[model samples]
Target: MSADQLLDALDPDQREVARALTGPVCVLAGAGTGKTRAITHRIAYGVRTGAYTPTAVLAVTFTARAAGEMRTRLRELDVVGVQARTFHAAALRQLSYFWPKVIGGAPSRILEHKAPVVAEAAARLGLGVDRLSVRDLSSEIEWAKVSLVAPGDYAVAAAAIDRPPPAGYDRTTVARLMEQYEQAKEGRNVIDFEDVLLYLGRILQERRDIAETVRSQYRHFVVDEYQDVSPLQQWLLDQWLGGRTELCVVGDPNQTIYSFTGATPHHLLTFSTTHPGATVVRLVRDYRSTPQVVDLANRMLSRTPAQRRREGGIELIAQRPAGPPVGFTAYGDDEAEAAGIAGRIRRLVAAGTPAREIAVLYRTNAQSAAFEQSLAEAGIGYLVRGGDRFFARREVRDAILLLRGAARARAEEPMVEAVRSVLSSSGWSPDPPSARGAVRERWEALQALVALADDLAAARGGTTLVDLVTELDERAAAQHAPTVDGVTLASLHAAKGLEWDAVFLAGLSEGLMPISLAETDAAVAEERRLLYVGVTRAREHLELSFARARNPGGRAGRKRTRFLDGIWPEEGSGRRRPGAVRGSVLTGEHDPALFEALREWRSRVAAETDKPAWTVLVDATLEAIAELKPASVSELSRVQGIGPAKIDRYGATVLAIVAAHR
Candidate 1:
C-alpha cells in the first residue's frame, strides 16, 4: 500500500496521528478506539513516505503476542526490518551482546520461577515458607525492584505506602527477605526477569559507547500501552533515548489496572509537561462496541473521583448502531447465579450466537469454580483464560495416548462413538461427577475432548479416529486445544484488550467489586476502573449480576456494589435492582397503586420523623410490601430490609397500607 492509502484508511484523529511522525507524539486512546491501527499505520506511513528507515524504528509493547501482532501488521503493509519487541526482550538482546565485554560469561541463566528461591530466603530468615507466603513475598520483591526501591529502603517505602507484609512476617522481616532473595540469586548465579532491565540500564549508563551505538541503531520509538509503564521502565526508556526524544506513546488512562504490578499512568498522563512541544491527539471514536455498551462504560467512569480522573480523558463515541439495554440481575446465591448465566448462554447459543463469542468475567480466580461446574453440567464448552491449558492436563494427555493407540489399531466405529468408547475405559462418563474436586476437573477435561471429537466429525463428515488423532496432535503442537467452540471464562484483568459479543459480569457485590482489600480511595477508583473494563468488553449484550449469599441456605447479607448507586434503576419501575429479579414483585409485577401508596406513607412518616424516606423504607421494601400485601405487622416485619427497629417505627402504617390495598 502507498503512503496515501495508509492515510486513507485512518479517521481524522488517526490521520493526525499518522501524519505526526515526528518526535514527542502522544495518542490518548480510549478503550476499543483502534489504537493499534493508528500506531501501526503511523509507522507504515512514516516508512512508506521515506521519512523513516525501517531498521531505525523500534516499536515496543508489553507482551510478546502484541509485539508479534505489530510485526505482522507492518509486514502486511509491505514494510519490514523494524524491531518490534517487549521492553525485556529488547533489553535482554542488548544485555546479551554487551555482557562478555562489560562483566563476564553468558550473563546468568534467567530465573523462571521465583517461588522456590523466595521460599528458601524465607526459611533462612526463620519466616514461614508456606505457598501463599512465598508467592506474596515474590510479588512484593518484584514490586520493590520495579519501583526502584532497594533492600534497605524497602521497609520505609512499604510503610509509606501502607503496604502490608506477607502473612507471617513484618515489614522489617520482608526487607531482610528481600536481601536474602538477592543473595540467593547471586549464590545460584541467576537473575530474575526484572534483573534483565536493571542490569541493562546500569550497563547503558556506565558504557556510553555501547549506549551511543544502540541509540544510533534505533533512532525512533513507538510505545503501546504506555499507561502501564513503571518507573523502572521509564528509566530504561530514558537510557535508550539518551536525551533525544523521538517517541510516540499510545495508552488509555481508564484501563490502567496493573498498579499492583508496579505500573502507573502518571508518566502517560504527564507526557505533555515532559515534552513541551509534543503533538497530542485524542482517539475516542469507539468502533468496537455498540452505543449502549459504550454509554454504560462512560457512565461508570463519570463517577470517578475528580482527583483520580484523567485530566484530559475523552469519552468514547460509539460508531456502531444501538444494542440491547444492558441487563442487571440478582440471584439467591452463587449456584443460582452461575446456573442462571449458563441457561442464558445456552439460549444465546441456540439463538445462533457462537459460544466462543460469549464470556463470563469475575474479580478473582476462585470465583470461577461455580461457573465452571455450572457450564460443565450444562454441557457448554468453556476455556478458562489464564488457567491451566487443556492439553497440559494429565487426563487429557492420557486420553490422547489412548486415542492414538486406538487409531493405530484401526477402530471401525464412527469418530464420536469410537472416541467415546476409548475414553470410557479411561473413566469418561456421560454424566458429570456429583463431587467437585480433582475428580470433577479430570472429567471436565476428558469431556472437552469428547466435545472436540463431535465438532470435528460435524465439521468434516464421516471422519475416522485417525483423523481425530491427527487433529489432536496438531492442536497439541500449536498449544491451541479446542478453544474455538468454547465460551471464555476470565478475570476482569485477564480480559483486558479483549472483547466479546456478549459479556456476563458476575459477582458484582460490594466486597467483590471494590474488593475487600481496596481500603484507600485510589484503590477503590481502580476497582471501579476494573468494572469499567469489564463493561466495555461487550460488543452487543451485557449483563451485570450478583448473588446475595455465598451458598444456598446461607444468610443473605450481601449488598450490591456502591458504585452502581444511581446507575442501576430503582425497584418497581419495571427495572432490575441488586436483589430484585425482573418480572418479579420487586421489579414491576406488584400493584403500582399499592407501591405508590406505600411510598407516600413512607414519605409522610419521614417528614414526621425528619429523616429521609429511605430511612423509613426504601423503594425496594415498599415494592415488596405492596407485592406481599401483608395483613399484619408480623408479616410486614418478615420482608427484606425491614428490621425490628424499622418495624417498631413504621410497621403499623405499612401493614395498614397493605390492608387497604388488599
Candidate 2:
C-alpha cells in the first residue's frame, strides 16, 4: 500500500504509528480515542506493506468481549489472519494442547465457580459457614493461585492472616485440606482456571521447542488493560515474547480495581524499567464523558495524593458534569432509605428517562428487599443481579430444609448430608478438615442428627415428607413474592463496567460501608475504589442515600459514611442542599395543560414504536413535540426537528391526533 492509502485508512497520528510498526511500540490512548484505530491500522499496514504476515501478530485484551471487538476492528481495517484472545482463553488453549506430554493426564475439569469448592472444603473440616463470606474466601484462593502461589507457599504466607484459611481455617488443617483438594482435582483429571497458567508456565520452562513455537506464531503482541497483568500472567507473556517478539501494552493504572485478585499496576507503571528502550506514551484527553463529569473525576483524583504516575498517566475526567449535582439523602431507617431511592427512580422515569437506563446499587445483597418491594409497588420494571435470584439460593434452599426439618421425619443422615452437599454445591463453606478425628466428628454428628430425627418421628404423630416440602414451598413463596419486579438491584462490586443513565447508590452508612472492620489502609482503599466504581457508572443523574438505623434491631452506633462528610461538608458551600426536607419524595406530577398539549406527542411516538430505536425516535424529536405541540401532520413536519423520515412514517397519525383534539 502507498502512503496515501495508509493516510486514507487512518488519521495522521494513527497512520504514523501504523507506518512505524517495524519495532516495538506502545500507544497510550484514552478511551474511545483510536487505540483500536492505531493497532488495527498498524496490522493492516504491516500486512499491506509486505513487512509482516497478519498471522504473526497477536491481539489480546482483558475480556472475551474486547477480544471480539478487536478482531472486528482489525477486519474493518482489512487486517486479516490475526488471532485475538482473552488471557484466560489463550492460556487454557495453550496449556490444554501441551498438557498431554507435560502432565501425566488431561488437566482437571475447570472449576468455573470455585465457591462451591471452598464451601465443601469448609464443611468437611467441620467449621460453621456463612455462604456470603465463604464465597469471599474462595476469591482469596483464586487471587493466590493466579499470582502463582503454590500450596506450600500459600500455607506459609496465610499463616499470619487472621482471616479464615480455606483448607481448615488453621495452619495444619488448611495445609492438609489443600492437599486433599489437589488430590480430588487430580482424581477427576480436570484443570481448574489457575492450572491453565500455572501448568502452562511450567511447560514453557521445560519445553524450549513449544515456547519457541508460540513465539514464532506471535511475533508482535498487543495487550490491552496491561496494568491488570499478574506476575504469573506476565510470566506467560514472557514465554510468548522470548527474545524475538515485539510488544505493546495499554492500561490505566488508576483503574486497577482487581488488585485484590492478584493483579498489580506495578507492571504497567514500571514498564520502562522492564524494557529500558521501549517507547512509552501517555493519554490525558478523555473522549468518553462530558466536561462536568470529567472535571469532577479529576477533582476526585487530586484526593489520591498517595499514588502517582498512573498507567498511561491518565485519570479520566468525565467530559463534563453532564448531569445534576449528586443527590444525597439521609434516612433514620433502612426501609425509608430503600423506599426513597425507589421513589426517585419512579420520578426520574416519569420525567422521561427510560427504565433500562436506571440502576439501583447497594452495599450488600441483603439490602435489596425494600428497594425491590418499593419498585414493584410503583410498577417499575427491573432486573436484579448477583447471588441466586432463583429458588436455588442457599438462604431460600436452607429455609426450605429447616422448614422440612421442623415439620417432617426425613432420615437425619441423608438430610444433613444433603445440606452439607448443598452448601458445598453453593461454594459457601470454610475449608473442611482432613484429620480422621475431624472426619469422624462430622460423620458422627450427622448420624446423631438422623437418630434424633427418628426419635422426633416417634414422638410427633404423622409427620410426612410431602407435607413438609409443601409447607416449605408456601413459606418460600411468601418470602420471594415481594421482590419479584425485574429491577436490577446489584451489589456494588458486581455493578462495575455497566453504565446507567440514572443510578441510586444506597445504604452508605459508616459501619455498613467501612463495615466496622476496614480500619486498615488496604481495606479502606478497596472500599473507596468500590465507591468510585459505583459513582462512575452513572452517565446521568446519580443519587447517594443512606440510613442510620436499618431496622428495629439497629443499634445507635451507625453513622453517615465519612465519605459524605468529605463530599458534603458542613461549611455550607461544599455540598448542594435542598430547600425543603425533601424526604419521602413521591413521583412528580405532570401538568394538566401540558398533558393536553402532549396528546400530540403520543400519536407520533406510538406510530413509531414498531420502527428502529435510533431511526424512528430521538430525544430531540420528543423535545420538539413538547415545545411546538403541533396539531397537524403538516404542522408537525413543518417544525424543523421533524424531517423527511418523520413525515414519511408518522405523518398521517400525527395529523389524525391533531384533528381529534380540534
The candidate scoring highest on lDDT is 1
Taken over the whole model, the C-alpha lDDT of each candidate is: 0.82, 0.60
For model 2 the TM-score comes to 0.68
Model 2 score (lDDT):
0.60
User: Highest TM-score, which number?
Assistant: 1
Candidate 2: tens digits of C-alpha lDDT, residues 435-489: 2222322332233223333333444545454443564464335445543334577
TM-score of each: 0.74, 0.68
lDDT for each residue of candidate 1 in 195-281, tens digit (9 for 90 to 100): 999999998999999899899999999999999999999999999999988999999888989998899999999999999999999
Q: How accurate is candidate 1 locally (lDDT)?
A: 0.82
Candidate 1: residue 340 lDDT (0-100):
95
- Root-mean-square deviation per candidate: 13.5, 14.1
